[model samples]
Target: MRKRFLVLILLSLPLGSFSQDINFELDFSAVYWAPKSNDTIRISVGNNGRYIFTDSEEVAKSFGSITRRFQPAGGKENADLKLLFDLKTIFMLMEVKIGQNTVLANVDLNQFMKKGKSIDSATVRKMSATPTALKIENNGKKYKLYGVAPDNKPDDLIYMAFNEKYPVDYDTYFSKLMTSATGELFSIDIPSGLLVHVEDSKGEIILELLSIKKKKQKGSANIQLKLE
Candidate 1:
């Protein structure tokens, strides 16, 4: 009877744990700046009490070209196959604020690399951005704004300020914004010589711009294109 009772308890434990709902919300925001050209990118993500996924919006304007890539938690390469964003540089810059304390993360892209790429320990440490007020140029006008935040209030305010400073069609902007936000493996091929900004909800920011110059040889093209 004692052994039978113990089995019943053990079987019930899994059910009890599964019965409890684990609900969580994650809010992310980011701003990318180009010091030399003076351009900025601003974005925000709101996860509605579901820790599994979130919704995002991005607004970008620049003189040249910019490429944006999105990757979720288990490395960019491990993203769901159905998602449409490029998995090449699986890097993300993410911040999580559970309450008052915030945890900043910079997911390293090298971890997602398949086999032989050299891994730099220093690169792993370089992902967090210090919180600060930043000056940015949007649509040929200058605006001072805070770096990234974990709340939508500040981001909404900045959006309003941007509209006031430079008049543009918000509807068209929003349409493009939605496209960029939905695709899991999408990449924007920006023209060269243009300043760009990137914001991500997943606390991993892999700045591919700096690493863009290295041209891959023909032999390595296969590995780079392998989506899985």
Candidate 2:
């Protein structure tokens, strides 16, 4: 029987200042496969990432009536607070509903390569070791970083892509929180910017991004995020 996989992706736009609050929409899909099982999970994000609604009746029941959102308990600093709050909350609930056996192990680069997966060994190692410190490279954008400020890239891709999309402190607070002695908040080493892909090195999960985009209702037309 072919083993099934799961993928988890976190994305957020830098906080942008518009004349008026705008309404944006998010579309997410998750595909699950087993020897005798094949199902597609679809989720719609509304209310500025505060509400997550599903089209599947069975899946909806699984999530329960409780809503998942970022209602920081106060004074508690988390690196992925704003960017991954909704998705993280949903995943935590899943671990409880689906049982621990279904939960994937911590991602390990060496173990993944041994399994015959093709990816940048050195780069993945760097990212896995120091996600905050390492940079993601793709589409002519080399060594892209997420931090208090942007790197020396003439195009300002990282900043322009996220700066106005999410809160400014999202990166600043996260960077500081991650470096604290208390330790990292997220289990995975995620670099900054709008993440479009993820590889669960443990082989338990293999999530792919179907589509991720942002639409402006009314605001200054600016550069949008592009991940290829």
Can you write out model 1's per-residue Cα lDDT over 87-140, one digit (the tens) per residue? 222323333322222222333323322222332222111111233355444446
Summarize candidate 2's per-residue lDDT along 1-228 as a digit string, tens digits: 322222132121112222122233443323322222234444444333433334454453443422132223443222211112122222111221121112111222222222323332222111122223544433344443332222222232221122123222223233322222123232223333333333333322233224433532221112223357
Model 1 lDDT-worst window of ten:
216-225
* lDDT of model number 1: 0.25
- Structural similarity to truth (TM-score) of each candidate: 0.18, 0.26
After superposition, the stretches of candidate 1 with alpha carbons farther than 4 Å from their true spots are: 1-22, 27-228
- Model 2 C-alpha lDDT versus the unseen true structure: 0.28
**How close is each model in CA RMSD to the real structure?**
21.3, 18.9
Candidate 1 TM-score, C-alpha based: 0.18
Q: Residue 48: error of model 1 in Å?
A: 15
Model 1, 28: alpha-carbon shift in Å? Answer: 7.0
User: Which candidate has the highest lDDT of all?
Assistant: 2
